[model samples]
Target: MATHLITGAGSGIGAIVAERLAERGDELWLLARSAKRAAELRERFPAAHTLVGDLADPGKLSWAFGHQSLPVELDSLVHVAGVVELGPVGETPVKVWQETLAVNVVAPAELTRLLLPQLRLARGHVVFVNSGAGLTAHAEWGSYAASKFGVRALADALRAEEHAAGVRVTSVYPGRTATPMQRKVHQQEGVAYDPERWIAPESVATAILTAIDLPRDAEITEITVRPGR
Candidate 1:
């Protein structure tokens, strides 16, 4: 079984993906921002390993990538950690904008750069959990949209650069999934997007696993899964 490392593994899509990876007998290194959440994940997947680090911090990201305690290489990396900050362009604070960009774009890019050697060793895959916002613009989501667009571009470039090295980069655009982040968005906007109608977390997790398990010759470049309605 291949070894997988997932960031934002504390909750939402990240947590769900970790659970599924562990269920499938894949060894996992879960990175969470919170110690409590890391402990919770450890409890949920007793067989899986855990790492606690905040990707938003440059030092933490460096520590996570450079630490010798963990394996120097991984067979796959599922980048599910990102931020969504909603506000009109003028109203958004500089700090909020930085945080969003850091988590959604800069952090992932830096992590990828630092971990490139490790991935190259394993000739592994990179899974980016993107958003529909990355594909289209929406109101008051400028920061988030910009970050995701950068993410998409990064994924595309990585795929092109690593195709010859047997590294597969898959970008998954999941629209309106049921997660705490979505719920927060709904509360702020006063729009109750139906959970049942939305794409379930497990469904998206399945798509991720499928991409990881695919034969090296076949590549699922991009998958956009949304609510049926």
Candidate 2:
């Protein structure tokens, strides 16, 4: 069975992807921010493993992982965890940008670095669940958009650097997915949240799966998922 280490498995698209992979009997290593969250995720995915590391402090992930046991070889490392804070550039504080970048970009980069040997050994895939904001910035989305954009760049450069090692990288840009993060985005935007008005988490999860499950000879470099409606 393919083994995957996934972040953001507690909810939304990450949760769905973990469930689908588990249903197929794939081995899972889910990343949790703390012991409490690891316990909760263990309850949720009874057969999966959990890793404790705080994404809020990317600088410490190396030290944290040093104390934990990581997979010897991994078929995939999925970066689905992200944080967003909506505000105009003039009003957005330094902390907001720092938090957004920490969770969305820096942490993923560090995590990938930590797992590169395993990923290379298995010829694995790296999936980044970026938002459409990564491609285009909109008003009131400065901080979040900037982080996504940074993540997009991270994906691109990693793909180029790791291609010789057979480590495939893909960035999935999902548009306004109906997730808890989307709800928070709506709250920040001062608007109503209608789940039916947005893309389903399952669709984005499917996109991620497709990229990872593709034939070894090919690579799906990027995918943009828009609302079906």
Candidate 3:
């Protein structure tokens, strides 16, 4: 069974993906901000290694990973932890912009760097759960869009640098999904939250699983999932 590490594994797309992987009998290492949720996941998936901490804090992440007796190799590293702070460029707060980039971009990059040795050992896959915002910017989404764009760049750079090492890097650009984060976005936009109008997290999770299940020799560089009209 493949050993997988997933950040933001407590909720939304991350939670669904972790559950699916656990069901498939893959060994799971889950990182989330909630200790309670971690405990619940540990109870549900007895073999899972759960860590409660903030992904944006490199020190905490280092401590969590270091304190654990994890395997030397990992089959996949799925980066699903992210935050959104929506506002037009002129009106956005500097603090919000900083936090957005710190969590959505820098944290993932640092975590991946720390895990590169393990990923190389297994010739594993790195999946970034990016958003359609990463592909195209929209009004009032300046901070979020910019950060996701950085994620796209990060994935592209990693793919180019690691292909020779057999470490496949994929960036998944999923359109607005029916997630709590999407609901919050809708609230900010003063629009009704309609599940049917958005992509389902499960669909995105399925796509990620497909990427992970591809032949070791094949790499799906990018995947864009949009809601049907």
Most TM-score-accurate candidate: 2
lDDT ranking of the models? 2, 3, 1
Collision count of model 2? 0
Task: Identify the superior model by TM-score, candidate 2 or candidate 3.
Answer: 2
What's model 3's TM-score? 0.94
Counted clashes in each candidate structure: 0, 0, 0
Off by over 4 Å in 3: none
**What does candidate 3 score in Cα RMSD to the true structure?**
1.5
Instruction: Flag clash pairs in model 1.
Output: none
- How well is each residue in 51-141 modelled by candidate 1, as lDDT tens digits? 7667787457776545535656788999998878798998999998889988898888887877787788999989999999999988899
Candidate 2, 123-206: lDDT as tens digits = 999999998999999999999999999999999999999999999999999998999999998998889999999999999999
Q: What is the C-alpha lDDT of each candidate?
A: 0.85, 0.96, 0.88
Error of 3 at 135 (Å): 0.5
Residue pairs with clashing backbones, model 2: none
Model 2 TM-score, all chains together: 0.99
Model 2 regions more than 4 Å off? none
